[model samples]
Target chain A: MTRLSSAQRHLVRFTLNGKPVQGEAEPRLLLTDFLRQTIGATGTHVGCEHGVCGACTITVDGELARACLTLAVQIDGCELRTVEGLAPAPDRLGVLQAAFRRNHALQCGFCTAGILMSLDHYLRAHPKPSEAEIRDLLSGHLCRCTGYTPIVQAALEAAAELAELSRSDHRDV
Target chain B: MKPAAFDYVRAETLGEAIEVLAQHGGDARIIAGGQSLMAMLNMRLARPKVLIDIMRLRELDRIDSTSGSVKIGAGVRQAALLAWPELATSLPLLSKALPWTGHAQTRSRGTVCGSLAHADPSAELPLALVALGGELHLRSAGKQRKVAAREFFAGMMATARADDELIEAVSFPSGNARCAFREVARRHGDFAIVACAAVATKDGVRFAVGGVADVPTARDWPRLEGSALDDALNGFAHELDARDDVHATARYRRDLVRLIGRDLVREVLQ
Candidate 1:
């Protein structure tokens, strides 16, 4: 189903969020450029651009990847998510975003979105994580401002809050 | 940080990847999970005119055990291998060393053969592979060859693999041994300044050192039993030629080579 188009350009088609999107790009086009420039999702930041920093992280087919390194044409049959597409709807904060707000997880807010995306996916899979586990999971993410304590606290608080909400849902059911 | 413009080819099968490598020759670079290659490409340390992505070669992504050997495909990711309970129970040295290679996110994309190809002397997998006495499988157009782990690693960031060949899988025998890996690094997740993997078998013990050699070294064979181990442990400090690094001094690395080596020997033999 997948084959090389030609030397210079390759046409790729895949769904971004709930919408079908397609693009023709140079073979050297990074996925970050395709997302921010071609697809206009500015939520994905190109931090470090060299993969040393995790600010360029995004979920590709439910796995975290540095979008700056992944070529645009590589995700032809993949599901991609940038922080801009994170909310239930546009311009709205999701559970992780709201958790950051209430728990003061962000300061300068540059790395917050990528952290949220990574943590959001992690929390969805793991509704509750211990403090050490939180610290361990956040090793890849670096936040110069908040000292990471607040972010760690935010994740813990969010996990507890979500557990309480889920417990109430079970009782109501 | 844009990579140089090049042709992109997705190899659906390992054969396709081999053919692409043969056709493209020196112009090609094979990417398994793009963990190390991507970083290198961005830094301009490595630039190839053609990239052959072998990530979708599902036929090559596997880990299995036979009667006396365990086979691990080259395309197996580091995180996947770290999560393998079987490997942990069977090969704890590898499990202990995986976290020392890179951060969790990077390890999620890094692959075994990818690590071998990158051949960072500070890397943990190579030392572990050396102590484990593994074999490397190399394949090219119409030819396949096997190289012992001791032979595959030639120098810094180098391997015995031909430009037109790709690693297939690594098979290692279980020698009824107890293995352990230890290291000192700048931080918990950073690359090791000095690391060692030690395996103790019925006949003898094997000690492999990384981060100290241009290429990692595995020695201390012929079973330094009892007084011999004590002598080595006592004077092991002199055997190393460690160079200064950002995280450690040459003298400190030399001492650590002995100290950690002795402790690991104790953990293995006792």
Candidate 2:
């Protein structure tokens, strides 16, 4: 058993956004703080620290997780992806981000980071998701802006675009 | 909100975790998924001196069905169980209720045993356990014991589990016991204001209600119809002793228990 006392910070190493990162965290330090403060990946926003708002949503080992609910020390040796990893390039937006822009999916943008992360992970698994399915998935996220209609539209449009891209890629192959 | 400072222990084995629990007792909290506990920690509802991470205990992640019951281990997350291929056929009640336990994000990390350990009155898992007559397998450093779901949950946020004992697994009996579930909540993933689950029994149907009582309570009834069934449901609803809270009023809960209870029992019976 590896026991770290609460009196001091301990070394925590993990892969963030496909890049290796290390930090020091006390036992009580949440992963949300670690990502933003220690790793300086501020794209993962924190809305409700109690895991209700879903603003801290991210992927740990490819599975969607609430960063606030996860302790920083517990994420050692795991592959994590945050909202920072969503866009393929810093200068350009990804397909989903572009879709959100076109559909006017976000307003305040406090909840967009988490919603995008969730949709990114969800759309990958469900390429042909129905509007109801997208709505159901979005239930985890609480959005005050756009009333979620545009968000759903953006997700469906993105899914269709991704499917078309995949089909075209297969043809080229 | 931030959690109070605590020591962290990543147990390499079940014996190690049990030993730590045996030493620290109530001061030590075992964390698998931390979906519920983390919230408690952040809100300072649970301030343990030591948080034991049992997620690394791969041996405890099994979902065994060889014994004719679906035995889910402690490390088995809610999403894993929901994604189980035989879940719909083997444990239909869980299939209907798991989606209501939490959202997809939290379910990916929330464990089945963890939810039972939290023992929230409005949680769907405990209600399903009680309605299905499941068993909770608890272990300490010295010994292990199996607890009936009905007897295991003592009250809201409470259980019969000793501080030194960790829930190893929970087994739900797999059979064609026609069952149905329904919950009334403000949001899709919010805690239920009133949730009901019914399963066909030998003589009749057993109705289990959550979010109204301090604990999920189940009562079995012989086949009855019309006003007779209505009377039984009314009695059961009153027996829950619900109170007016921010989410719902006592009268509203009682009405739900009677209305949803009647619907679930009918569905299961048919």
Candidate 3:
């Protein structure tokens, strides 16, 4: 078709946490809209409606992707992890989250979810990134409150905690 | 806030994607990461009637170094390029320019082919690729052709991509050469207002400046040293046709062209 076509595409089925969920959406429907409106997973917030804001961030098949900029139809068989799915099970406040809370990393809580999600991945990839590296990585995210000191501290503390845990595990070995 | 409705086709293979493009024609858009495409789609700036999702194209997602050149698949993500080892040793300029991309999260999904295809005049990768003398492999339904980096970039947001054609890969020649890049932008991760990539080869010095002119302008000066080099650079700086944009003025960009060009060539080459 010369003009854009709207089709009632097949239901998109995917896993949230360990459960399978299905929903119907058009090719143009955004994954953020699908998550918020369909499943009511409001933890993934929408800020810029573009990829600029980290608020609508989520983990698709373990990789961080902006839900706001992704199409719902694209996630047919992928596994998604949202903030709601993250909690004490991975250890209370999840290390990064707990560190943020302990260090008072958030204030207004608007950009926290996105940063938390992104930091989750960043910390996993780089357990102990330097103060400069933390700042460099966090440069991808926006934090309006805490002036980034506390957040950066939280990330720093999380790295230390992760290092300790790694040492403990190695000692156990 | 939502993108316009479009016909979605998840191509199972590269041939299918090309066929779909041939049938659907110009209104069809191929999306890899959708990092750049989705933004334009949402703003209604790009309302492609047919959206071809090429995320599953396995062939276009490879990065391999063969012979002396590095063959980066069109779908090779930006993060992949940053992680590639040869590009670092063979072309250090590409490595240095990697951080100037959008961000880590965006780089995780953004593809090299898409960036070259989008051909933003001021972007780092394109300028680096041009300076390195990369060859873009463009594939159509029945034919595939390679265009040199010098001829690939037409202008701002413009490239040599043709209708019913897709970028197969981009290959840059390998050499024992030194390279450097300098770009001044509004913010750290923001697009460049003016960027230049300079290559110091055994032959001579090549200077390519983007975000200052319509298309990338390259100049190869006769090897000069001392005051002669400074005088030539000053003359070239005064002769550029820079434009005024929201980020910078024509005058500021022109001066940057001279300063950065001189800085990179003199420091890296000399």
Candidate that would win on lDDT: 2
DockQ of each: 0.52, 0.92, 0.45
Q: What is the CAPRI rating of model 2's predicted complex? A: high
Write the residue-wise lDDT of candidate 1 on B52-163 in tens digits. 9888888889988787777788778888888887876666677678877777667777888788888888888788878888888889999999998889999889999889
TM-score of each: 0.92, 0.98, 0.92
Shares of reference contacts reproduced by the candidates, in order, are 0.49, 0.94, 0.50
lDDT of 2 by residue, A1-173 (tens): 99999999999999988889899999999999999998899999999999999999999999999999999999999999988888777788888999999999999999999999999999889999999999989999999878999999999999998899888884210
List the candidate 1 regions with Cα displacement exceeding 4 Å: A1-7, A170-173, B175-177, B221-239
Per-model lDDT? 0.79, 0.94, 0.80
B128-242, model 2: which lDDT tens digit per residue? 9999999999999889999999999999899999999999999999975599999999999899999999999999989999999999999999987889889999999999999
Over 4 Å off, model 2: A170-173
Quote model 2's iRMS: 0.5
Q: Provide the global lDDT of candidate 1 against the true structure.
A: 0.79
lDDT of 3 by residue, A26-55 (tens): 889999999989877788888888788678
- Residue A21 lDDT (model 1): 89
How are the candidates ranked when ordered by TM-score, highest leading? Answer: 2, 3, 1
Interface quality of candidate 3 as DockQ? 0.45
Task: Give the Å shift of residue A141 in candidate 1.
Answer: 2.1
Candidate 3: the clashing residue pairs are: none
